[model samples]
Target: ASRTETVKSVYDKMLNSIKEKKTAPPNAWLWDFIAKCSSKEDIELLFDMLQKLRIFRLSSLRIHENFNTALCREVTKACVRVGAIEYGKKAALWRHNAFGLTPDIGSTHHLLLYSKQLNDVNLLVEVMKLVKKNELTIQAGSADIVFSICSGADRWDLMTKYGKRFVLSGIKLRQSSFDMWMEFAAKKG
Candidate 1:
């Protein structure tokens, strides 16, 4: 296949055109370029350029308003695909906090795993805060993520609180979760 338009090609075109004209990229072309990305790298490249433009105050409000929930969802999906869990959480948080997009179960799972994998208790706390602030339903799978965060962060108080809550909620704790609590209990005794 003789490909005329590629991600790099589109990026180069946009960059060059913007540089020459000192104008914001047209909304349609910009969104089209973003939508045509075939890999995570392309998405990151687009974000990099957008970030630079935003920092320099060259971006348009039209773009921001147009971004809406769909762009945030794309960023979340792309970040996870690229193993950029930190970025994924950032995107998810921005989507909810900035754009007022409703949180989905998948995003909850991503934030939960990202917090544990990144060893970021604050991110995990942010996830919980969002749920409570929004009054979202807590799924049983949340217990698993809470256990992981508590175990990794050594937040025994949270472990104790959520552990009892898990039992009361009828969610079976993993063996390792129980082990973490037992270890904490032994230390406290």
Candidate 2:
């Protein structure tokens, strides 16, 4: 079957399950498949389906913590792949609001990664603001991405700001993160 057909089939089945009040949630694999298949055109469809699942209180969805984070990360990746960075931001906020999902580090990392790839300091700042608003923990990997973003953009101020935050938050800096921070500080001095 074609990708569209498969997506449509799964979409229909999920919708029917919600309508019929199925006690069991769909398998994690199904959600993973949807996330992997998400694209610019069909991203709204994916978001709508997720909203519906939450609205109907489908099978204690929040219980699947691992799946939820993976889904968010994959969806963010799909959005980045298609250059739909705004949609990705909206999706992250939407998941936080609608499903009570915390923005995971992986999702934040992916957005930051793309911000670096695009060399857009404004986008990097926006993603960081979202992270701050959501109070998501800054992990070592994400710190590396932020440091890289600041380094690439020649934004020493941003590097200092977030570097201090990471230090105060007690997040362990990876060796690469340390290297970038020190290199930038030395250059600034």
Candidate 3:
């Protein structure tokens, strides 16, 4: 079947199941298949399918079941690959808000990963705004991503600004990310 037809078929099935309130397992292998699509358009089409079918929730349920964190990461990566930054950001947020599992540290870092991969300063800055508003805690990989973002942009002003927030919260960077903090510190000095 053509890619378009396949996407439409999968989308229709998913919506039908939702309408029927069926408890059947997800296509069970759909994302794995979607991730393997070679063309960017094909990948974007799959992302569209995901959005249309509410597949992000299905994937989130799998993550909740401890199926695999890698699948969560792969979906985020695929969303990024297809330039679905906003959707990818929303997916990352859902994984945290819905499942309570920090698939890359509570979506903040996952969104940071997407921003870094996309080299989207605007998105990064938006995340910074969120950090400011919520006073969110940065942990593990999320901390690393935020630190890398700060250092990559040479935004010591922003780093020093947010660094105070990190220090004040008593959340230390991971050992692996010490270098990034050091870079930030060095630049600030």
Report the Cα lDDT for candidate 3: 0.59
Worst-scoring 10-residue span by lDDT in model 2:
58-67
For TM-score, candidate 2 versus 3, the one ahead is 2
Best by lDDT: 2
Best by TM-score: 2
TM-score of each: 0.50, 0.80, 0.63
lDDT of 1: 0.63
Residues 27-62, model 1: lDDT tens digits = 566566656665667666767765645533325333
| lDDT (tens digit, per residue) of candidate 3 on 19-125 | 56644337564664455554455555555555544444565344324324455566666656666665555445443333222244454566787777766667887
Off by over 4 Å in 1: 1-75, 80-101, 164-180
lDDT of 2: 0.74
The better-scoring model by TM-score among 1 and 3 is: 3
The local distance difference test score of each candidate is: 0.63, 0.74, 0.59
Candidate 1 residue pairs that clash: none
How well does candidate 1 match the true structure in TM-score terms?
0.50
